[model samples]
Target: MDRLIDAIERTQNPSVVGLDPTEALVPAQVVASFADEVRDSVDTPEEAPAAQLAVAFYEFNRTIIDAVAGIVPAVKPQIAMYEALGPAGIDVYTMTCEYAAEQGLYVLADVKRGDIGSTAAAYAHMLTGVNAGASAEAGSAGAGAHDPWHVDAVTVNPYLGTDGITPFVDAAKTADKDLFVLVRTSNPSSSELQMLDLADGSKVYEHVADLVERWGADTIGEHGYSRVGAVVGATHPQEGRALRERMPRTFFLVPGYGAQGGTAADVRGMFDANGSGAIVNSSRGIIGAWRTSGRYRKDMSADDALALVFDTAREAATAMRDDLRAVL
Candidate 1:
């Protein structure tokens, strides 16, 4: 946790590249490259589109990862996007996670997977390599007994309370992994439940944030960041500040910047006095830049699109870092 936090601080940026691919938002070149392969193998257009999109999506993700690995501290691949496409999609998701790790980038599997007891354990194992299935040299003597295909961390939902979070806690402690539990989300509709005030005057999410702080205490690292963290959307600046104060040692994963109407200023409060406690994520704004009509594509080739997106994202992230530094 300390190393990761140090990296973020040194970079002076918290932007985490998010791989949340949607078929419609993919570039024409990506779609075209795999269309023929999918067309020949599948019987229906719907199936063919998904098949082609999944292939292109993973390749695009690799390209983006290659472009931004050194600039960003982490990459969050949203699981729902891959799961929506089926088994082939899952293969791509696993490959992307492994590839990200190989590139020396921290992978935060944005699964938000939650359950109780045994089922939760299964989810923990799947995300963090606790009971990792197999290694390349699994049967070889002295070939390393434990599989190391684990992610640096994973995002989880805390709706079910402590029981729902114990497995993740165990996984983090046992494997030196990390967890980012959702306290307040960025979506417009999250307020429907999160903002509801209880009879005691505290909001539902306030209660959640309080528990997250306590849960993370046991996992606090030398740098003052806990292995257990919280996901607070950048969209709610005031609420994010409140949550930051409530969970001083908890690392924060802030989503909703860029395309979600959150500017660099919106997330500044989540950081500690040293500017090292949060990671801001932007998905569509960074990955789907090619879809911005013809303006951004005027002089750029498909191969250069990812690079251009990375350049723009890096600039935005840098500006945010500067903004925070000025305040801190």
Candidate 2:
């Protein structure tokens, strides 16, 4: 938590770029460019397409990471974007996290994993890196205990209650990593559960917010924030503001800013008086900037397309920084 706070202060930017790449977001030419490279690398023709896209996803993530390395303090890479392609994509997701960390940026993995006691402990290994050779994607047989995920934090689901979340909290404390529990999400369907009224006179999200704060109580860092963070969507401004007051020690991983129609003003209340408690995120709005930049050409070569990706992504990231800075 202190590490992330230091980064935020150093970069003076509390906005994190979401490195979520999709087939529609990545340039076709770039995907095609890797056809020859992965054609023979795959086990069969059925595996070649996914393998090529996985490689392209890495290239896209690498380019975006290089572009925004110094401007932004962190990046949130949603695992589902890569997991959709199967095993090859999962490798790329880890590769993206490793690269972002290598470039001195915080990586927040949006995995949202939750389950009962033992199962939750197994998932906590992501932060603890305690499982040796857990996944072959992990560097080597003995490298699993050495921060194989390369992420500073991860998003978790709290539906299973304390028994489910305690492992992640303990793992975070042991590994000096952090975790954000989903509270008030930005998606349209999140309200189906998060906004439900509990018999205790509080909403579902409010109850979860209290649990999240309690879970991180013992691990508050020098920055006045705990190792456990709350994922509060930018779209729910009034509620987000109240949550900010409700959980002073809990940091925020705010999502749904740009593409989801959340403006800087909408999230201003999520921060504390010092403007240091929350970090906002923008996914397609940044990584997919090239598509909407009007500077892209279908006929452009792979190198040229990637160059555009870098330029546009950087521009968008800078703009987002300024936008958030203006309000803070």
Candidate 3:
């Protein structure tokens, strides 16, 4: 956790580039490149199209990783997008993660998996190699013994409370991995449940935040960020600030910074005194920037499209840091 925090501080940017590859948003050239291979392999035209889409998606992610690997502290790969494609999809996901790690970029598996006991352990092993298992060994070998998955951390859901989180906690400690527990999400509908008043007058999310802080105490890292971190959405600046105060030592994995109503000002509250402690993630806004109406167009050449996207994302993150610097 300290290493990651140090990396972010050194870069002076908390931006976390999200690898959220969607089939429709991929560059036409990428799709064209795979069309012939897909068409030759599959029987039906429909299957051919699907195969082409998958290939394009993977290539798009690889390009994005290559573009921003050194500019950002981390890359978050949303697992749901990959899982929706099946085994071949998972293969791409694994490869992309390994590739990101090879570039010395921290990979956070944004798999909001939540279950009790052994099932949770399985998820932890899959994401961070926190457990001792054959899959872990295979992963370690595949990433190269020295590479070892290259994942520094993972994001988790805490709806099941301590039981769901304990396995992840144990595994992260054993493997030097880190866990970011979802507390207050950035979604518009999150308040329906998270903001509900408890019997003791505190909101439900408040209790969850307290638990997250306590759980993180045992895993505090040298840079003051904890191996056990919390996910507080950037959409709610006031709430984010309150949560930051409550969990001073916990690293924050903040989503919703782009394509989800969060702006540079909205996320400013996440930083600590030293302008550390938080990583702002932007998914569709970064990876799918080319599809955002007039902002960027799908018809642009892949190189030009990607260059524009990288510049935009880099500028957005730089602006946020600059704003924080002004305030501090």
Candidate 4:
């Protein structure tokens, strides 16, 4: 958590670009580049299309990382995007985590995993490579070039309660990594359950916040924040402000900025007075700028757009950085 905060302080930008690529969002050229062998199978068989899609997603992520690595402190790759392609997709997800770290950006695997017993432990190991084993070979390998699934942190779902979340918390402590538990998510439907009032007069999310503070008690870092963080959506400014007050030492991974209808003004409350404690994320607003915005959109082939995509993405990233700096 301290390292993440330090990176944000150094950059003076509490923003992270989300690498949530999909077939619709990826450039046609990238897909075509890897689809030659699989093209025939895509029309007849099913296996090849998934394989080709995994490669395309990887190539697309590589391009996005190259474009924004110089500007942002972190990159979050949603695991589902890669999982859509099956095992090949999962392999790309691992590769993406490794590649982003190689680019000197904090990799937050948004896996949202929650379970019980060994299953939960397995999720922690596979996602963050935390508490994998104590073998001399494993220790020597380290969390680097050899560790393909290494991530600085992971987002987890907390609905299953402490039994499911503790493994991740323990693993994060052991590995010097972090965990962002889902507290107040950005989706509109989140309120359906999260906002329900308890018999004690506290909201569900507020209760969750109290639990987060307890879970993170021992893992507070040099910055006076914990390795156990919370995912507070930027879309709910009032709730965000309340969460900040409730979890004073909890780092926040604020999503829903930009494309999700969250602006800099909406997320200002997530940060502390020192302008630290949180990292805001923007996905399509940065990655798919060329396709969404009138300023960058063009009717060109994916190959033609390829030349401009990185440049457009870099410009969008820079703009987002500037926007956050203006407020923070």
lDDT of 2 by residue, 1-328 (tens): 9999999999999999999899999999999999999999988999999999999999999999999999999999999999999999999999999999999999999999998977887777778775554364322112244666788888999899998898888888878889999999999999999999999899999999999999999999998999999999999999999999999999999999999999999999999999999999999999999999999999999999999999999999999999999999
Error (Å) of candidate 2 at residue 73 is 0.4
Worst 10 residues of 2 by lDDT: 136-145
Per-prediction TM-score: 0.86, 0.96, 0.87, 0.91
lDDT of 2 at 143: 20
What is the Cα-based lDDT of residue 295 in candidate 2?
A: 95
The candidate that achieves the highest lDDT relative to the unseen native structure? 2
- Clashing residue pairs in candidate 3 are none
RMSD of 1: 4.2
Report the C-alpha displacement of residue 75, candidate 1, in angstroms.
0.7
Q: Which is the winner by TM-score between candidate 2 and candidate 4?
A: 2
Model 4 whole-model lDDT (C-alpha atoms) = 0.84
lDDT-wise, the better of 2 and 4 is 2
Candidate 2's C-alpha runs over 4 A off are 131-144
lDDT of 4 by residue, 73-141 (tens): 999999888887788889899888889898889988898998874567766664434334454233221
Candidate 4 RMSD computed on C-alpha atoms after optimal superposition onto the true structure: 3.3
Candidate 1 lDDT over residue span 145-197, tens digit each? 34444477888899888978888888777667788999999999999999999
Q: Which stretches of candidate 3 lie over 4 Å from their true place?
A: 41-46, 127-150, 292-328
